[model samples]
Target: MEVLQILHMNKGNDETSYAQNSKVQRKILSVVKPIIDEAVQKMLCSNIAPIGSMGIADLGCSSGPNTLLLISEIIDAIHATSSCSTSFTEFRVFLNDLFSNDFNTIFMSLPAFYNQLKEEKGAGFGSFFISAVPGSFYGRLFPAKSLHFVHSSSSLHWLSQVPPGLDCQAAGKALNKGKIYISKTSPQCVLEAYSLQFHKDFLLFLKSRAEEIVGGGRMVLSLIGRSSSDPSTQESCYQWELLAHALMSMVSEVNT
Candidate 1:
């Protein structure tokens, strides 16, 4: 199956949905708030003129409370920095994600979100136009040189697709058998395939963003990462290992 076509977080407000289980993502946003603030601050302080309408995009913005939290934080930073000026009056906020994402849930929450914004930022608060753009961030999604500030959190580690040749059907056998992600026991080819995919996807991501982001635009991206040079390091792959183990146990029970 095509990963992009099938991949998306659980939808809705149910107990198993991403909206209910995204506390880790929320924490990630909190950890990166200062960096986001710093980027917005620098963007405002820059010489980019005609600041009446600022374009901002949160790529891979999964549906959840954290989806709007980033926008709120950006608005807060702008308010703090532009208190003395009226130059920044309009906001064009883009929330982007995969095609299968639960955009309806996000849209349903917009009315209340706007109300909160109005109540907190006051009547004089600048107008914002928020729209959802569904697609992969590995390619261009916005008009050329349109975005000023880009923010992505807890999302970039997702490659554009599964690394080539690792698919069991295509490879004639399971390459990284019994494991969904890199592990210490993963073969050299499996490791290299994943690494190559990441590098390729990341390069495309940067190139696409470069075309969409203005000359002085800033991007802040946060994702699960490893400190060591090894891709199979426990810091990065341990979660996947645990998940794989759980899945294997389920398969064993089914077979029995």
Candidate 2:
């Protein structure tokens, strides 16, 4: 039993790690690309020339292979937008994420991405200035009305932490008794805690982005979401469920 428990705990840790890694900020860029393009087109149509150093940001930017890919798309969108107009302004990008994120990986990749940008000229894909910002998107990470465009994906769904009011006793019993994710039969306290966290986080996201984006600036967000309005439907991605199961398995193993 002790050996089984240890194995489950290790499996859970891997599952959780896998879940976090696969949900980087870049995955949703394509989903919102059309919106970004339209926003850029509008800026051009409005004669916003010399775009005056447009500020772009990617929030909840996790460290992974996909991070740089999204940055490139954003630069392309900006230049495409700028080209339609006469804007020749230098572009500055802010890549934002939590302090604990693997910023080192992002930083190390910058020189190559920057050098490539330097090589392109007189095109939307050309030059761009980039910086990695360490912070949470839920808080004020940018200056007042400083951003012209913002992008975030697979990030907003994350609660800062697990909900506080979850009934540990209930959660423990569920795992010990061989239940999976909190089901419809789960305790209301569990569901309420999760719902409140999501609601609070969503509101914070709106307020912060609203304050940072200029009056006509654009903001794009893509995230994992529940298929139904009901929180107990358990229709989220299988990866998420696998991670949750791993967590419970780990907990039960340790107790044995």
Candidate 3:
């Protein structure tokens, strides 16, 4: 499937856009801050030899407040611990996401972002160079052993495409009817199909990232998954059922 050609979060700062709806993601970032801080500290300290530059990539780095904010946090951690370390004098930050992501919005925000970094770091932040690399993280986006730190939040739950065995459609019947994802109403096959897709995509993601990240590198990720073995568990699957009901209600109202 050409999943790479179509995956993108909603754009802009409007009510319906990802920018406005990313508070949950921001909260996840906050929860993971200490981990991030520790990772940067260790990455800096582990560099016994001068490495010239530190390469950092934020996979699924959708554009918005969290984008530059996360970068700022990482740089601060590095400075607090390794500002004087000649092992890494420069920082290369890669902001990566799908091709259709609103890179323009991120780019426009850069002028303000750069100014804020300078204001906060007092010109020492001048060492950080940022760039956009739009693509899927399910595959390799960086060269081998190039990145020292990686970060991704609220992005990996998405599969490259709809799971297999779900493509079955006849004249009128739907395999997983009246729902957008695996729900209580869905059959066992639907759950298995979805799980299989996730396993395939996630494995590929790890394999790809493994090649790009350097020795002693670290990655921080936040994704949606279930603690239970059963995929039909309400805690993991109820939200989609509710959404389906809401969507069908709207459709019924329009039709009537």
Candidate 4:
């Protein structure tokens, strides 16, 4: 098997299977961390509910080092909020990803993660009830009005799959043309379709969270974004093009 096929097989149908895309994923998280912190604090202070406790969920939480890094930031923020609030409140941290994801990896790693935090940062900081629940964040993943903060990074923009036929040739075309994703002149229809899917996915996210989060609950999302809303710009989608070629090459090799 080629390297990509091996990686895909390792994925095993998990949402977090996207872990293979680690470099870009980490880049996405780095850019969004500060924004999430601010949003969480605002939610805690807002007038929607008593600040006695908080529930924070990281949607599309993939397993690995990056997940741990994200949880650390969240724990710090929660502790800071708990310290300043007059009412004592506990904290719940939900790590959510697709059912196909390696939640087992997350669970197995948690004790170690917790131990490291306690040893490095001290135990008295913030009390966290950490749990990993398997589910797709593309749909509702929490109880209604149950969350105080929601955060996701690098995940929101990935389409469940690239548009169908995106890999297929025009019925009569040959592989000699040698391309799979964007060409110099992909029709506007394809771009618009992808954009529409993003919009729909984003709306579902908002709607689900609207009810799951209390009135003052805050959401912070950071994903790979376009330089602008223009759909036709190559700058906005160069990575998708590269990934397609990579996948296509893998498929070709596997069949041969």
Candidate 5:
């Protein structure tokens, strides 16, 4: 299956929806809030031409409370640092995610989000214009030099697709059989394929963003990672290991 067609989090307010199960992601966002604030402040205070209108892009902005929470944090940082001389009067906010993301859920929540912004920031707090841009961030999704600040959290570990030759059909056999990701038992070839895919995807991401972000723009990206260099380390692939085990167990039960 194509990853983009099926890679979204469970949608709506169901028990298994990403909206209900994203506490860890929220914690990660909170932990990185200070870094986001610092980056926004520096972007604003830099000695560049005065910005009357600012462009901010939140890449991989999944649906839920955290989506608007991130926007609110950024706005708060801007409000705190804005002086009469350096105040921005207009904001162009872009929320980006994959084509299959639960964007409708986010859209349904916008009325309350706008109301809260109005109540807290007041009538004179400037204009916020938000739009969603749907696509992969591994490639270009915005016009050249159109963005000033970019933020992404709890995303970017996703490759554009599964690593090449790891598939059963491509390899003519099940390479890394019974596993969904790199594992201690995965052969050297499986590890190399994943690493190569990551490098290729990441480099494309940087090149795409380079065309979209202005000269002095700032980006804050927080992603899942580990300190260990080994790709098969438990710290790096344990979650997938457990998931694979569960899936294999289900398969065995079905066959039995």
Candidate 6:
């Protein structure tokens, strides 16, 4: 719980904050733009089309330039594909993140975002209703069939809590020593616990999203992950292994 207390990006436009270090996420979104465009195009053309308004949610939307980028792209796609048969009159965009997220920063930067939108799409480019939604994405966040499109980027690695492990070497002691997550020396049980927790979390995410999205709605998820099944594999965990080595080397130097 103590760790959870401080689990948010740094506030303001600081050098060491998520706002300044999210270019990689922006590029990923650019790479997936075609996919989003196709999905939005199809959703707009669906028989149960967007009538008067459309509901869109950007889950795990950190405060920064990236906050409104997804919504902007979605709006562009819809407008580009719009005709007499399919045209939007309004948009309700939900910016979702954890309770600890830097929401104030987002609100502060919103004036610029709106101005940009207005300049690009005109003042009456479908009444844009933006709101903040604070919560974990592991459970239901919206009403049933309430969303037309949902997007999350550069998240999904964070667990809601420490995964329960049965194989404690001693009471309240972790089986994996001196490692925050799966390591080369971690027992098989540690891997199992982490995997089980991931499974449960992913299942919960799907169940919750299912209740919120209509049949033809679309969801895009971007996460930093590996393709390997083995947690200790080099390609899967070299970053952590290198970090552990660097930290241990520093400690050894200090001890000596």
Counting clashing residue pairs in each candidate, in order, gives: 0, 1, 0, 3, 0, 0
Reference-based TM-score of each model: 0.94, 0.77, 0.91, 0.79, 0.94, 0.88
**Least lDDT summed over 10 consecutive residues: which range in candidate 3?**
43-52
Give the per-residue Cα lDDT of candidate 5 at 232.
91
lDDT of 3 at 82: 57
Please provide, for model 1 over 1-256, each residue's C-alpha lDDT reduced to its tens digit, 9 standing for 90 to 100.
7899889999999999999999999998999999988888887787666546889999999898999998899999888888433577899999999999999999999999999999998978799999999998998899998898999998998998889888765347688888988999998989999989999999999999999988877999998877898888878789899999999999999999
Ordered from best to worst TM-score, the candidate numbers read 5, 1, 3, 6, 4, 2
Which residue segments of model 1 deviate by more than 4 Å?
A: 83-85, 168-173
Which regions of candidate 6 deviate over 4 angstroms?
Answer: 2-6, 49-51, 84-87, 170-173, 243-256
lDDT of 3: 0.84
TM-score of 3: 0.91
Whole-model Cα lDDT of every candidate shown, in order: 0.89, 0.66, 0.84, 0.68, 0.89, 0.82
TM-score for candidate 1: 0.94
What shift in Å separates residue 5 of candidate 5 from its native position after superposition? Answer: 2.4
Over the stretch 160-233, how does candidate 5's per-residue lDDT look in tens digits? 89997787654476888899999989999999999999999999999999999888889999998889989899
> Would you list the clashing residue pairs of candidate 5?
none
For model 5, what is the error of residue 83's alpha carbon versus the real structure, in angstroms, after optimal superposition? 1.6
**Candidate 1, position 132, lDDT:** 93
Over 4 Å off, model 4: 1-21, 86-88, 161-183
Q: Measured by TM-score, how close is model 2 to the native structure?
A: 0.77
